[model samples]
Target: MDGQPGHEPDCKSFSYTSLQGGNIPESEIIVAKRKMDPKTFSQEYEASFESYQGVIFYCFNRTLSASNETVQPNDVLHIGMDFNVTKMAAVVYVRRGDQMHAVDEFVTYLIRQQ
Candidate 1:
């Protein structure tokens, strides 16, 4: 679909970090960096796509939207709620024409309701 009309693809790049939601452990990241720079390791999302993405890149949903669309008050609103044991999050999208734009979002931890 490259160069196709109305084929706006979304690609979000995330650097590797040992913080929470980071699929790679600090030790692994450190080991990977032995042959590459820190910047290289952080941005290397392709090497372990199946392993890394399967774990959920928790932050991807927030900014992964078509930003050009504007939301009118009369336009239908799309609110999505998603949660797992580690975190809970919500995203708000507005449909303009046929495309949806993420106008706002919220993220919160402590997802598991105990």
Candidate 2:
């Protein structure tokens, strides 16, 4: 999919194949197994998000988007809210280290428009 604006390209799903054909090496299989582990995957995601410095916000529709990675933490996350809309947003902050700071924050918006 080209990076052109308004281009809704087709999405592809993951296709898994059996390794009985001896095409996949043993080391590759081990790494794949570890990555497939739920605990390991979650921890890796958390680590990646934590290490990255930026403002992450999830929209009211449970959509997660991170932007302004260059912005500092002291800066209040700027959000545009529609006055005519009946909805609210929740922010999730995750910190790293013994004294974790606001490295990444997720904002989830909830809409209850009739």
Candidate 3:
């Protein structure tokens, strides 16, 4: 195992001796025990693990992908909006052929007198 001190809070603790004694190879064990960045590990790793048991998008049957297409001048734009006292949000969509693509989203913060 590397000499780096283990200070990462989110990663599970494992001893070098246990890892070495196991049937698994040193390389694989080292990789499995490596520390993940706190922000990414917290947001993506924990959420995916807890919600889907390590399978991403467990609730969805189809995989969703992102596209880089922009809205054309002639394309019809559809907007959906949600408003609250503290925040407002909107989504912009454009129809291309038979498919509707979400092109942009906007959120604004509103300040209210306490």
Candidate 4:
């Protein structure tokens, strides 16, 4: 225990639901649980393709959650998805002949059917 390479004897890890993160509000906790599964939300780590990087971040005069973009019936839809057993994430875009506009993003945890 005296000396170990790549080891921190005093370092510890705790989840948000655990003793250390009790101060978090119930509303936010509920959102976090919904965005991620209980385990991933608690452990706070994942090699996710995307994680609350928000739906959009590069454009000016645009909000994150709400956008004015609308999809027409003839528009070509381009979607990017990260599908997994535990969670599913997707970004939706409407493609014109030469350009694509960001429209929506969706993420949800999968429910086991039994």
What is each predicted model's overall lDDT from 0 to 1?
A: 0.60, 0.41, 0.57, 0.61
lDDT tens string, model 4, 1-114?
Answer: 324545677765542334245666678767776886544564563323334344323233455445567877787778888675567787788865566677877889777789
Each model's TM-score, in the order given?
A: 0.37, 0.27, 0.40, 0.36
Task: Kindly list the per-residue Cα lDDT of model 2 for residues 64-98, writing each as its tens digit.
Answer: 33323443556544434322233433343333333
Better of 1 and 2 by lDDT: 1
Best by lDDT: 4
Point out the higher-scoring one by lDDT: 1 or 4: 4
Best-to-worst lDDT order? 4, 1, 3, 2
Report the number of the highest-TM-score candidate.
3
- True-vs-predicted CA distance for residue 27, candidate 2, Å: 1.6
Q: Compared with the true structure, what per-residue lDDT tens digits does model 1 show for residues 1-114?
A: 544555545634444434445776778666777965444455673343333332333334445533756567687779887675667677788876676778776788663457
TM-score result, candidate 2: 0.27
The residue-by-residue lDDT of candidate 3 on 1-114, one tens digit each, is: 233356555555454444345665767544544654343343433333333343222333233434566788888889877674467777688888888777777888777789
Candidate 4: lDDT of 18?
42
Model 3 TM-score, all chains together: 0.40
Error of 1 at 24 (Å): 35
